[model samples]
Target: KLRERLKISGDYHECNETNSSLLLLTENNTSLDLNISRDAVFGNCLDLAVKKFQKRHGLVVDGVVGGGTQRALNMTIEEKIDKVQLNIDRIKWLPREKNERYVIVNVPEFMLHYVEDGEIKQQLAVIVGDRKHPTPIFSENISYIVLNPYWKVPEGIVRREVIPAMVKNPNYLKKQGLEAHQTWDENSPRVDTSWIYWEEYLYGQKKFPYRLMQPPGPKNALGKIKFKFPNKFSVYLHDTPTKHLFKKRVRAFSHGCVRLSQPTDFLKTISTFNPKINMKKATKRLKGKRKQFIKVKNQLRIHLVYLTVGINKEGQVEFRNDIYNYDKYQKRRIR
Candidate 1:
């Protein structure tokens, strides 16, 4: 009955390389007249259309009508209506008061919007957190910017990741330009790697005394800059070395911190709020090898929200997958 109302005609056929070749041809930028065929055999035109639909819907662009794609294609009008209503309720929970300017990161959409006077001033793609390391939804103020930033490896990552890697290869720290410190203090003494027992650290027999830090450089994981905000979660927005990940439709790669696609441009936009922020000097600082923290004159409100369905500027109902399963939880509550 739902499928009949939605007019979902047929199940997506098993994709083949022949159909994928047609998909490649469509991407060639030359127009090819491939007639729409009946047999539900994924043809060049249909495959290309499916890919475009997937791209627009923020799904993985594999050109294959798999489970995820099939589910999206099969969504009934009633389902979309329910999602729209639920998102409306979610919006009501947010503060009704408007700020003069602010930053909003919609997690499911994988995008950030900088707004002023209720108008969008700037927008960019962002990589949010995955399920295992979910990005928290909350409001905070972006207080400062760190140029040529060093990455203070998170304690959880250090325990779960760094120690294991070091156990396999002791040179991992040196090769990655990372250093271990006895304490998180600015002037903490550096720990000599040779004296450390990797197994003791990994096995929890010995406490890892040092905090792992990567010095600011081309290979730095935090890229050239970081936007600081006060949050109990210790999560902040920053640039990343993995810029290629931003091109993907579903960008939930970060542990918790939001990774900006265009950090430089984002910096410039926020810099305008405070007269003290000098973009000239800031850009110059980005060239330096040392990490420098620059406090902005005015703090901008930044909200990390999980809105899977929204009404865009054109007033079209845009939907995205519930990357964090917030929609599923909300649906259960509705029931």
Candidate 2:
């Protein structure tokens, strides 16, 4: 009954040389084939079945059975069934309130959905954390938006990246628009590099108590805007200066934060949540090196979720690659 209900498109046709591969793949497989004959021909039933399978697994649903669809097809019947069941459980655990608007970042899919009243209002491509620093999954409320924000270098990054670069080239920090401060506080004093003990911090001989921040500019890592949310993981959504990364099919380049492709468009949607925000005036503030923070009157709910499989609007199954190997890890626990 589950397979019968999936909406299928395309007309039935007799098996031809071109469809021989699709025929052998989709036919005689009880998991995907809904009683289709094992003839070496492409027909209406086979086309529908392939489309249904593609949609259910989050494929392009082109009914062409390309490389991605072929990979999905290669999964055994038991594995496919297991994936569906696992995702169904995930659905059951989802937030059930229908009236509330929210944002969802599907990690595996590399996409973000701005949902309002159970419908998608805006959709954008997002770059998530890479394999080394896989994006942590959690829920939080967006508290504010920062214009011309400063990029505070995390400790891990400072140790692994900034320190080494500085050791090789003393002027590296200045060239990169980074400034060293005495402390991490808002009113902390900036420090001149010449007077600081760089060697001690480099060799771990002494604790690095100072903070490194990249001020707002065209070359800034965080681009021009940043969306702040309340989360223990210190992960939030922001714009990226490396615009070419968004063009890639798989965008897992961040250290641990979500990078927005359409931050300005997202800002427009954010304006609706707070009466104090006038997007026209806010756009003017985003210019230059001045840092400005705008707190929202009503916070928006945001969810950073991990789902490799889902059912799309067409009621077809959709699937994505488990980039972090999270599915393998989770399934082991279930077993």
What is the TM-score of each predicted model, taking all chains together? 0.84, 0.80
> On residues 200-255, what C-alpha lDDT tens digit does candidate 1 reach at each position?
88856677778889888988989999999988998999999899998788899989
Number of clashing pairs per prediction, in order: 0, 14
lDDT by residue (tens digit), candidate 2, 116-216: 97889999999999999989988888889999998998988988788878888888998898888888764699988867657778856567888999888
Clashes of 1: 0
Model 2, runs deviating above 4 Å = 1-70, 195-199, 203-205
lDDT of 2 at 306: 87
* Residue pairs in candidate 1 whose N, alpha carbon or C atoms collide under 3 angstroms: none
**Best model per TM-score:** 1
Model 1: lowest-lDDT 10 consecutive positions: 24-33
